[model samples]
Every structure is written in C-alpha cells, then in structure tokens.
Target: MKYDTIIIGAGMSGLAAGVRLAYYEKKVCILERHTTIGGLNSFYRLRDRNYDVGLHAVTNYAAPGTRTGPMAKLLKQLRLRWDDFDLSPQVCSSVVFPGHKIEFANNHGEFIEAVCAEFPQQADGFRKLVKHIEEFDELDLSQEAVSGRKVLGEFLSDRLLIDMLFCPLMFYGSAIPNDMDFSQFVIMYKSIFVQGFARPFAGVRQILRTLTRHYKQLGGELKLRQGVQEILTKNGKAVGVRLDDGTEIEADNVLSSAGIVETHRLCGTSLPTPEPAYGELSFNEVIFVLDRQPQDIGHNETIVFYNNTEDFIYAPPEAPIDTRSGIICSPNNFKYVDSQQLEEGFIRITALANPQYWMSIPDEEYYPAKQHWCDQMAAAAVEHIPDFRPHIVDTDIFTPRTIKKYTGHLNGAVYGAPHKILDGTTGVENLFICGTDQGFLGIVGSMLSGITIANNHLLR
Candidate 1:
C-alpha cells in the first residue's frame, strides 16, 4: 500500500497519529498486529462477560471545558463525541491502610480538608502542597525533563502522607513518585483533581470502539492482522514497512506505536537501539472481574487498600504501585450502575505481580501458575468483602505475558517507558517515543504524550 504516512501499532498513540494525519487530509494507513483495534485499551471475553485487559478508567473526561482536555479535544477534532455512553462521576478515591482510611476528593479544597480530617497535624503541609500544585503553570507534555518526586518533596514532609498521596498517583503515572519530574506531576494532578475523573458505563472497550469509528470516518485505512516485520529504510530515510507476510508497503514517514523495543525491531537498521529505562519492565496487576457484586460493600468510588509501604517501596526500583501487599477495588455501587441491570452486579479486584518473578517461571508452568495467582488474589479480595466469594459466577485473569502477546509491549508493561526528569529526551532523529514509556501512564498521560509527539513532530 502506498500512503502519505504509515503508522505501526493500533494503540492509542498510533491511532491518535493516524487520526490527526488523516484529519489534515493526509493519506494515512494504520497497520496493527492484533485482529481487533485498541492496543492496550482492548478487552477479552469469558462466557457472556467482558473484562478489560488493559485500561479501566480515564481522568479529565468530565472536565468542564470540552475541547481543553486531550481526549475530548481529539474527539472534537475528529468530529467524534462520547456523549451517548454512560459515564460515572468519580469525586473521591478512598485509600485504606489497615485501620486508617482517607478519601481523596476531586475538589482541591475538599480533598485537602478530607486529608486534614485524617491527619490534622499535617494540615498546613497539605495546604501548602495543594497551593504549589495549583500555582504550577509550565505544564508541558512535550518537554522530557520533569520530576514529580522533587515537586512533591518540597511540601510534603510526613512519610505517611507521601506514601498515601503520591503512591496511588504514581501507579497511575507508572513512574516512581520520587523520580517523576515536577512539571509532569503538576500536569497529572491538574488533569485528575482539577479537571475530573470518569469511567465509561459499558467498559473501556466501548471508548476504543468510539475512537475506531472516528478513525474510519476520517478516511483512515486500518489494516488489521497485518504485522509490520521490518521498517524498510534506504538512504537514511524511512521509506515504508515490510509486513510479516512479505508484503511491502511504501510511505513517506512511518510512525510506530508498537512500543520502544518492538518499534526498534521493526525499524531494523533504520533507528538506533533505545536504551532501557526504569519504567520499561514495571509490574501491573492481574484484574479479576467477578460476575456477582457484593451486598454489604457500602457506596464508595474506588477503594485502595495498602498493608504497608515496605513492599511497595522496596520491591523493585521501577514498580509503580505495590500490588504485592496492596489492592485497588471498583466496588458495586448503585450510583455507578445502570437502573436496568442493578440486580446483575459486578466488581473488579486488582493485585500487582512481580514482573521478574513471573519472568522466572518456566514457560510450561506459566499459565497454570497465573491461574493460581488469580485464585490467591480472589481469596485475598474475599478478605476485604466477605460476600465476594459466593457472588463470583465467572472470573478472568491477565498476566504480563498476555499483555505482551496482545499489545507487543516490552515485558507486558502496563505503561510504556519510565518518565525520568533528567534523561527524558533521548537524542533520536526523525524518531520519537511516547505513551507510558515516555513517562505519564493512565488515560490523561497517554493522551498527553500523544499530543506532545504530534505537536513536536507533526505541528513543527
């Protein structure tokens, strides 16, 4: 196929690039290895139930300004709207540590007040911290050098407060709170708390469907099951790509959302080898989706239970969220459910796994062990919600291997690269990287990274 731009990988980054290029009337072709669209945003089905394999919810979707947020603006630019979908308003995220529980609210003032209510001694420090985050202005997703740890450390002295506040956000960013750049942290905080957070009523896959529809509507050609084996470059320029089936497609420029390692492999001798970063091999959780919802679990937005910070901080240098001893739950709340299906309840329990540990397991033993891990996780969740075990009519578990096979990401990394404040920009010509790997995970950071890459390479 001959085109103006050839985009590799159908993930959000690749899709965003294709959408932008196509909207500008550029003949764009997106080649994806998967049979379906939405790389990490894709889902899997077990029986009649659908489970999200990658992304769950997004922040800043409910923000007041429609075209200001990254995803919202992209939809508008593509003449797409997600108004039809049912969206749940997440005003607070409840954090639980043994006997202690704190609710992080959406409103900045209210959030501070809530925190102060728990730890009154740290009230002044929390206020100053919020002030700093609110005052921060130079929020640029493009600039590679920004540390979140340094920014948070300035105002937060209590170690408990740091663990409570920065830990969850770090998981969302897929970067260590201490290592993250100040600017990125500011942008992330604004997107979540200042803007708003929301989840699609149907699930994450529905959002992907919406994006796919928009891409097709813009005259963008999508080639599914067409894996680009190599980037056919000649005379120091990206000419096109060679598919796995020996089919060669020519194009002016090749944009890869297949991740750093896969993109390098496809590029062959065209691009230099990308150096490994702290965030590349990070561990993500195996989300167990239960068929039945608990009856006693009271109304709560999202519950994060932390046993201790030791397992979280000392586990791996790059592990964003300590799932070994922690758990994040999306409980069954009447406010979040549709009126028709109120009886058919559902909930999600996520437990973080050690990537290295999973990697060490023998190939033949991997799948069975993964199932065992899911069982253990389900058991652990039952500890929190007693009625959870009986309500489970069906369950689905996804490991890093499943993520790697589906998305072509390195080590099944939930996000992409670790966002480092110091070495954010690696000198690669005509080649750019983004997504979780470039720092900033979750919906907001991923979309922001897409905007950064577009503004830097395309708009420039």
Candidate 2:
C-alpha cells in the first residue's frame, strides 16, 4: 500500500517524525529492522532485571514554552506525562579526582556556590569559568559558532577548569571538548543545566513504549523484523523500499534514522554515496547486567567511580572482580538522597570499555572477550565497594559484533556518528538525517535533532 511517508529506522528520530506526521493526519508507515522500536533507546532483560542498552537520561524536559524543547512538547502534545520517579535533585554529576571529588548541581548559582564552598581558593577561578560557560551557552550554532573545540579553547584559559569542567562533559559527547562546535556543546550543556536530567520510572524502555503507543494511536503502521535492503527509486526521488525478503513497500518520501552508512546503502542509486565524514563509525560498548545489586553504593545518586581514569573500582586490581568506570543507579530513589546513604546501598555497576582493544579477537571470541571485560570490571567495582561481589546473581555482556547484528549500527556506537563539523550535513535533496551521528548523541540530542530535521525539511 502506498503511504505519504515511509520512515526507515524506528529510533527516536524516526518515531518523532512518525508522531508529527501522524498528528497531521498524514498516512505514515514506520519500518523498523529490529523486532522492537526505540533503537538505541531500546532495553534488554536479564532474568527479572532490565538494563537500558542506551539512553541513560535526558535534559530540557522542564523548560517552559511549547516549542522550547522537543521531548517536552512532544510528550505534552501526545498527552503523556513524565512518570514521577525517585530522582536526585543534585544536578551536578559527581566527579572523583585522586584526592578530591566535586558534586555539580543544576542551578548555575547554586553550582557555583557549591564549588566555592568546597574549594574556596578556586572560587574566583570557578566563577569565571561558569561565566565563560554561560557565555558559551548563548552562542548561536546556526551562525559562526561552528566548531566546539575552538570555542572552548577561547573561553577557558585555565588548565584546572578545563580538566574539571570540560573533561567529564566531553565524555558525554564521546569527543574532546575542542573537537565539538560551540553551538553543539551549548545545546548539550543547556540540556543538562537548564532542562534538568532525569531517568524514567521503569527504565528507558518505558519511554520507547510510550512513543510506540503514541505512534500506533496516531494510526501509523509499524512493521518489525523487516530488514530493508535497498530504496526503490524512480528518476531521482525516493519512491519506496525493497525489503530483505524481496517485498516492496512504496511511499511518497523516506526518512532514515539508521546509521549514516546504512542509510546511504539503502538509498542506492537514488542518493549519491555519502561522503566519508557521514559514514565514520566508532567502537562498541561492553555492558554488564548484574543479578544481585551491589552494596556500598547509592540508591539515589548515580555514582561514577574511577580508580585510574579508565575504570571505576569497587575492589582492588588483584581482587576476584574489577570494573573500569562503574556507573551505579538505584531503581528505588528516583530522586536525590544523602551522599552518605548513596555511598552504601544495593546497586548496579556498568563498566565503560574501549572497543579498539578487542579488535584483534576473532568474531566467535567476542562474547568471551566481553565476559572477560565484565569480570575485570566487576572485580574493580568490588575493590571500591567490597560487598559488591557476593551479590552477583546474573550477568550479560555486549560486544561490537553483537551491536552490529542487532541495530545495524557500524560499531555498536550507542551514538552513531561523532559530533564534528563536517558530519552534520546531508548532501541529498529532500532527504534529511538525525541521531547520534548527526551531532545529537543522547536523548536530548535525539529529540532535538527531530525538531531540527523537521524544521529544516518540513517546517521551512
């Protein structure tokens, strides 16, 4: 059957587009390769516990104005409300240095005040740095503020502030501070600072479920397990798609949320080969799903404990288990809690891994490699929090191959493309793109990209 719009890749962007189109009473079909929706917003279950594959949290939901933020307005328009969960009010992500740790807050004034209270000697420096960040926030991305890295260098002259403020934030972008454009960085920073970052009540899966429900409610058709092999084009415009099973679905227009390279491949002769910048891939992540919650962790706060910059240790290196950069969050306290209490509780820990290190292994050996990394990460977590090991009830690991097999993302990059200058542009006519690669990495970026793409294409 012919449809007004056929969206490829049911990630957040695709879903957002479907929602908008359906709202307009346009006939739309959302074709997803996977059996489920949400793409990186997807989740998996190990026994009774569920782990979010991606989408840790999002910011900018609380901002006023209907069109201020994409997710907020979308939810409101869909008649959905943010499910209240036990979340921490601490806007500041806790950063642990060798001898000291810093807790960042949401309010700019309060955050600056806290920093000054913690390190009085650095007050002046910190205040100046905050002002610089505020100024950076005001820069327009649509204009000359094209490069993130250059703008950061110009704003932050102090070495300590650069390391303390920019390093952790850069981790979220998955790139160095200077490598990102000023406008992109400001969008990310504002999402966290102004919008307020918070996790869902059930998990990220809840958000996906809500989006899917809304999509269906709008009379959109979703076909799962139907891998699209190529775009069926007549002349120079996209007309439809050919599925892996040799079936064809026709449409007036196509929107892709698949990774850049895959989208280009699907377009076939309809669109030119996307330049190299559009197809660059990154490493995959290794995630561990714990059976029993670890002890000596917070149920209210998200703890990112790093022993040596690479890993967050709950135990020593020689211990039976160790983790590199353990991220712990409790399903209980969805809101803020006392740091002392959060330092000691039942929790889950995830170790961030370097994908390149596992490249030498054979495809069949990927699972074992993931297991080895999980064990090491678990051991490390036990060192920092001794009671961590005895509680392990279940574990599952994901490799690069696993990511490619499931989502068709180049390397299991949770965020598809690097947020760089050249990567954001799409050279195709009446064709647009969004997702992690198009410069929007996290939930906020994904949602914002939906609005950005729509504004560029439909609205304009």
Give candidate 2's error at residue 212 in angstroms. Answer: 1.0
* Residues 27-79 of candidate 1: C-alpha lDDT, one tens digit per residue: 98989999987787777677766666655456665543455655576556545
Candidate 1's error at 270, in angstroms? 3.3
lDDT of 1 at 457: 73
Candidate 2: worst-modelled 10 consecutive residues by lDDT: 311-320
Write candidate 2's Cα lDDT for 338-419 as tens digits. 4323222334454443444443467787666667766666666555444445544555565545666678876555545543
How do the predictions measure up, each by TM-score? 0.87, 0.81
Taken over the whole model, the C-alpha lDDT of each candidate is 0.62, 0.57
lDDT measured at residue 253 in model 2 versus the true structure, 0 to 100: 70
Give candidate 1's error at residue 48 in angstroms.
Answer: 2.5
Clashing pairs in 1: 146-181, 147-180, 147-181, 147-182, 148-180, 148-181, 416-436, 416-437, 417-436, 417-437
